[model samples]
Target chain A: DQQVKQNSPSLSVQEGRISILNCDYTNSMFDYFLWYKKYPAEGPTFLISISSIKDKNEDGRFTVFLNKSAKHLSLHIVPSQPGDSAVYFCAARAGNNDMRFGAGTRLTVKP
Target chain B: DTAVSQTPKYLVTQMGNDKSIKCEQNLGHDTMYWYKQDSKKFLKIMFSYNNKELIINETVPNRFSPKSPDKAHLNLHINSLELGDSAVYFCASSQGFGEVNYGYTFGSGTRLTVV
Candidate 1:
C-alpha cells in the first residue's frame, strides 16, 4: 500500500502565475517531508524540505506548508517559470530513515 | 563528476534471464537504497543497505537480490526475469540512516525491459 499519495497526476499553469502541488499521507509516523524536481531521463533533484516540528518553510520562490493534523503538505512556487516544468515528487521519512515517495505530479508551465 | 552513478542505462532481456545493475556513489554516504518505478509511476523501495548491511527489505520477490561490496557500491541482481519485472530502477544514497539534514541523492536510473 502507498503511504504517501499525490492525487493529482498532472497540472498546468501559465508562466508568471502560481503553481501549487499537493500531497497527502496515511501514516502519521512520517516526520520529515521533502520535495524533488525531476527532468526527463534525469534523477530527482532535492528542492525543499520541512520537518514535522514546523508548519511552514520557505526558500527563494519555493515554499512548503505542512499540516500534521491533516496529514497533508503542499509545495508552492510563485511566478512559475517555464523552466520549472517537470515531474515533482513528494517524499516522507519515518523515524528510521524509512522514506516513502508519492506517485509524483507532472507540472507544465506554459510560457 | 556525478555524485551517484548507475551502469547500463537500458537493458532488454528475455524471460528467465539474469541481469545485474551496478551502482556507485562518490558522496561518501553510508546508506544506500534501491527504488523501482513501475508502469503506475510509483516509486517503490526494494531494499536498503547501510555500511554493507541490509537494513530494509520490502515486499520484493526473492528473485531480486541486492549486494553491497562496500559502502560506496550497491548492486542489484535479478534472476528469472519476468515481463512484470520491467521498470526503471534507481539507486540513491544519503549520509546515514536517520539523518535528514541532507536529502538523499539518486542516480539517473536504469530501465530494465523483459521480453
Candidate 2:
C-alpha cells in the first residue's frame, strides 16, 4: 500500500504565476515531511521540509504548508519561473530512518 | 566534489545474472541509505547503515544485500535478479539518521534493468 501519494501526475503553470502541488499521506506516524525537486537523469534534491509541529515553512519563493489533521501537505511557489519546472516528490518519515516517497508530479512552467 | 556518488549509472543484464552497484560518500556522514525508485516513480527505502553497521532493513528480499565496508562506502549486491527488479536505485548520506538536522544528499542514481 502507498503510504504517501501525489494525486497529480503533472502540473503546468505560466511564468510569474503561482504553482501549488499537493500531497497526502495515510500513515499517522509520519512526523516529518519533505519536498524534493528532481531533473531528468539526476537525483532528487531537497527543497523544503516541515516538522509536524509546524504548520508551515518557507524558504525564499517556496513555501510548504502542512495540515496535520487532514494528513495533507502542499508546496507553493510564487512567481514561478522556467527553472522551477521539474519533478517534485513528497516524502514522509516516521521514527525510523526509513522514508516513503510519493509518485512525483512533473511540473512544467511555461514562459 | 560530489557528496554522494554511485558507479555504473546504467546496468542491463539477464534475469538470472548477478550484479552489484557501488556507492561512496565524501561528506564524512555517519548514516547512509539505499532507496529504490520503481517505474511508477515511487521511491522506497530499502536499507540504512550507520557507521558501517546495518541499522534498518526494510521488507526487501534476501536476494538483495547491502555491504558497508566503511562509513564512506555502501555497496548493494543483487543475486539472481528478476525482471521485476528493474528500477533506479539511489544512494544517500546524512550526518544524522532522522533528526531535524538530517538532510539527505543523494547520488545521481543507478538505473538497473533485468531482461
Candidate 3:
C-alpha cells in the first residue's frame, strides 16, 4: 500500500507567482518528510526536507510545511520560475526504514 | 565527472531474458540504493547497501538481486525478465545508512523495456 500520496497529478503557475504542491500520508510513524524534483529522463533530486519535530523548513525560495495533526505536507515556491518546472515527489520515512514516495506532481511554470 | 552513474540509459529486451544494470558512485559515500519507478510513477526502494553490506531488502522477487562488489559500486541483476518489470531503475547514494542519511544523489535512470 502507498503510505505517501500526492493527490494532484499536475500544477501550473505563471512566472513570479507562488506554486504550492501538496502531499499527504497515512502512516503516522513517519518522522521525516522530503521533496524531490525530477526532469524528464533524469532521476529525482533532493529538494527540501522537514523533520516532523518542526512544522516548517525553508531553504532559499523553497519552503516545506508539515502538519502532523492532519498528516499533510506542502511545498511552496515563491516567485516560481520557468526553470523550476519539473516533477515533484513527496517522500516520508519512519526512522531507519525504507522511504516511501508519492505518485509525483508535475509542476509547470509558464513564462 | 558524474557523482553517481548508471549504465545503459535504455535497454529493450525480450521477456524471459536476463539482464543486469550497473551503478557506480565516486562521491565516497558508503551507502548505495536501488530505486524503481513503475508505471504508476512511484519511486520504491528495492535494495540498500552500506559498505558492500546488505542493510535493507524490501519485498521483492528472488529474481531481482543486488550485488555490491565494493563500497562505490552496486549492480542489479534480474533473471527471467517479465513485461511487468519494464520501468525506470535509478541508482542513488547517501552519506549515512539506516536513519542518519541526510539526502540522496541519484544517477540518471536506466529505462528498461521488456517485450
Candidate 4:
C-alpha cells in the first residue's frame, strides 16, 4: 500500500508560466510535508516544506500548499525557468523520523 | 565538501556475490538512513540508525544487512545478491532522531546491478 502518491507522472509548462505539481497521502499521522527536486544523476535537493499547522509556505518562486483535511498538497513554481525542469518528489513525515516518498513527477519547463 | 557521501557510485556484480556500499555523513547529525529506489522510481526506506543504534528496520531481506560502525558512517552489505537487487541506493542524514523539523540530506546514490 502506498502511503503517499503523485497521481500525475509528468507535467510541462512554458517559460515564465506557473508549474503546479500535486500529491496525496493516505496516512493521517503525517504532519510534515516536503518537496524535493532532483536532477538526472544528482541526489534530491530540498525545495520547500509545509507543516500541518499552516496551509501554505512560500520561498522565492516556490510555494507549497497543504490541505490537511483533503490529505493533499501541491507545489507551485511561478515564472518557471529552464533550470526548474527536473523530477519532483513529495515526502511526508509522521511522528517518527521515517519519511514516505511519492513516486515523483517529471516536470519539463520549455525555454 | 559533500555533507553526505556514499562510495561505489556504480556496482555491477554477478548473482550470489557479496557486496558492500559505504556511506559517511559529515553534517554532525545524529541519525542516518538508507533508502532504495527501484526501476519504477519508487523510493522506500530500508533502515535507519540513530547514534549507532538501529531505530527502524523495514521488511527488507535478511541478505541485506546494514552496519553502523559509528554515528557518522552507515554501510550496507548484501549477501547472495540476486538479479532483483538491481537498484539505486541512497543514504541520508538528519540532525535528530524522529524529528520532522529537520529535513533529511541525501547522498548522490550508488547504483547496484546484479547480473
Candidate 5:
C-alpha cells in the first residue's frame, strides 16, 4: 500500500505564473511533510516543509500548505521560472528515521 | 567537498556475481541509510545504521547485507546478483535517527545493472 501519493504525474505552467502541486497521504501518524526538488541524475534537494501544527509555511517563492483534516498538502510556486522545472517529490515522516516518498510530479515551466 | 559520496556511479555486472557499493559521509552525522529506487521511481529504505549499529532493516533478501565499519561509513554488499536487483541505490545521512527535524543528505547514487 502506498502511504503517500501524488495524483498528478505532471504539471505545466507559463513563466511568471503560479504552479501548484498536490499530494495526499493515508497515514495519520505522519506529522511532518517535506518537498524535495530533483534534477536529472542528481539527488533530491530539500525545498520546503510544514509541520502538522501549522497550515502553511512559506520561503521565498516557494510555499507549502497542509490540510491535516483532508490528509492533503500542496506546494505553490509563484512567478515560476524555467529553472523551477524538475521532479517534485512529497515525503511524509511517521514511524522511524526513514521518510516515505511519493511517485513524484514532473513540473515544466515554459518561457 | 561532497557531504555524502558513493563510489562506482555506474556498475554493470553479470548475474550470480557478488558486488559491493561503498558509501561515506563527511557530515559528522551518526545515522546513515541505504535507499533503493526501483523502476517505478519509488525510493524505499532498505537499511539504516546508527553509531555503527544496525537499527532498521527492511524486508529485503538475505543476499543483501549492509556493513557499517564506523559511524561515517556504511557499505552494502550483494551476493548472487539477479535481474531484479537492477536499480539505483542511494546513501544518505542525518544527525539523528527517526528525527524528521533534520532532513537527510543523499549521495548522487550508484546505478547497478544486472545482466
Candidate 6:
C-alpha cells in the first residue's frame, strides 16, 4: 500500500505565476514532512520541510503548508521561474528513521 | 565536493550475474542508507546502517546484502541478479537514526539494468 501519494502526475504554470503542488498521506503517525526537487540524471535536493507542530513553513519564494486533520500538504512557489521546473517529491517520516516517498509530480514552468 | 557519492552511475549485466554498488558519504554522518527507485518511480528503503551496524533491513531478497566497511561507506552487493532487480539505486546519509531533524542527503543514484 502507498503511504504517501501525489494525485497529480504533472502540472504546468507560466512564469511569474504561482505554482501549487499537492500531496497526501495515509499514515497519521508521520510527524515530519519534506519536499525535494529533482532534475534529470540527478539526486533529489531538499527544498523545504515542515514539522507537524506548525501548520505552515515558508522560505524565500517557497512555502509549505500542512493540514494534519486532512492528512494533506501543499507546496506553493510564487513567481515561478523556469529554473523551478523539475520533479517534486513529497516525503513523510514516522517515529523511526523510516521514510515514505510519493510518486512525484512533474512541474513545468513555461517561460 | 559531493556530500554523497555512488560509483558506477550505470550498471548493465546479464541475469544470474553478481555485482556490487559502492557508496560513500563525506559529510561525517553516522548513518547511511540504501534506497531503490523502480521503473514506476517509487522510491523505497532497502537497508540502513548506523555506525557500521545494521539498523533497518527492509523485506529484500536474500541475494541482496548491504555492507558497511565504515560509518562513511555503505555498499550493496547483489547475487544472482534478476530482471526484477533493474532499478535506480540511491545511497543516502543522515546524522541520527530518527525521522525528525538531520535531513537525509541522497546520492546521484546508480541505474542497474539486468538483461
Native contacts matched by each model: 0.68, 0.64, 0.68, 0.62, 0.47, 0.62
Q: After superposition, how far is residue A11 of candidate 6 from its true place, in Å?
A: 0.7
Cα lDDT of model 5 by residue, B1-115, tens digit: 9999998899999999999999999989999999998998888989999899898998999999999999999999999999999999999898885566557888989999999
lDDT over C-alpha atoms for residue A36 of model 2: 93
Candidate 4 residues A1-111, lDDT tens each? 899999999999999999999999999998899999999878888888888899999999999999988999999999899999999999998666889999999999999
Per-residue lDDT tens digits of candidate 3, residues B12-103?
99999999999999999988999999999999999999889898899999999999999999999999999999999999998874443267
lDDT by residue (tens digit), candidate 6, B1-115: 9999999999999999999999999999998999999988988999989899998899999999999999999999999999999999999998886534546899999999999
Measured against the true two-chain complex, the DockQ scores of the candidates, in the order shown, are: 0.77, 0.69, 0.67, 0.70, 0.63, 0.69
lDDT of 5 by residue, A29-72 (tens): 99899998989887778788888889999999999999999999
DockQ of 1: 0.77
Candidate 4 lDDT, tens digit per residue, B6-104?
A: 999999999999999999999899899999999989889999999999999999999999999999999999999999999999999998854565578
Instruction: Evaluate model 6: give its lDDT.
Output: 0.93
| Candidate 3 lDDT score at position A33 | 91
Candidate 4, residue B68: how far the Cα is off, in Å: 0.6
DockQ of 2: 0.69
Question: Considering chain A alone, what is the TM-score of candidate 6?
Answer: 0.98
Could you tell me which 10 consecutive residues in candidate 3 chain A have the lowest summed lDDT?
A: A91-100
Off by over 4 Å in 5: none
Query: Which has the better DockQ: candidate 4, or candidate 5?
Result: 4
* Model 5: lDDT to the true structure: 0.92
Better lDDT candidate (4, 5): 4
lDDT by residue for model 3 (A1-111), tens? 999999999999999999999999999998789999999988888999988889999999999999999999999999899999999999998666468899999999999
- The C-alpha stretches of model 1 lying farther than 4 A from their native spots are none
* Candidate 6, residue A27: how far the Cα is off, in Å: 0.5
Candidate 1 per-residue C-alpha lDDT over A54-99 given as tens digits, one digit per residue, 9 for 90 to 100: 9999999999999999999999999899999999999999767788
Candidate achieving the largest DockQ: 1
